[model samples]
Target: MGNIVSCCSLDENKKYLNDDEILETFSNSEINEFKKRLKNNIQIVVLLQDGTKLPCNLQANFQEKTLCISCHQKVKNKND
Candidate 1:
């Protein structure tokens, strides 16, 4: 399917935000939440090799290969 995600807002990054920024009713570990998402999002640029896909502007690549112009181009196109 298309990135229908764009049509439906996904708040993939409400973690970094402090408690004051989000809805009330706290009860769990925000860091843990971030850790879960970190599993699959390791970008090639801006160097976040910790494997944590934090709210960044770069793109993700897990091919065990280095980032190249082609990868950058793909990320650009995806945003377009």
Candidate 2:
């Protein structure tokens, strides 16, 4: 497992894009649709440098445009 980093911190992650810094051709309606879908939940596949595809479930804060990574753990049954 890798170390967990805070996405909210600008100092921690310099890759964060400011509102003006981001260049998007999407219309307001399209952007709103994306935000709406994100609120429900979205599955994103990240392709690593080594060619590994990692699937992640995420939710977003519309105001901040920030993401919250979701993780689910499976519990083992003692009777099994």
lDDT of 1: 0.44
TM-score for all models, in order of appearance: 0.21, 0.45
| Model 1: worst 10 consecutive residues (lDDT sum) | 69-78
Q: Pick the candidate with the highest lDDT.
A: 2
Model 2 per-residue lDDT tens digits across residues 1-80: 77878656446655776776564657789989988889988987666566666677789987887889764542333463
lDDT of each: 0.44, 0.73
* Per-residue lDDT value at 48 in model 2: 54
Worst lDDT run of 10 residues, candidate 2, spans 71-80
lDDT of predicted model 2: 0.73
Candidate 1, residues 1-80: lDDT per residue as tens digits? 55564656657864565667563445467755644445445444443355533344332243654332223332222233
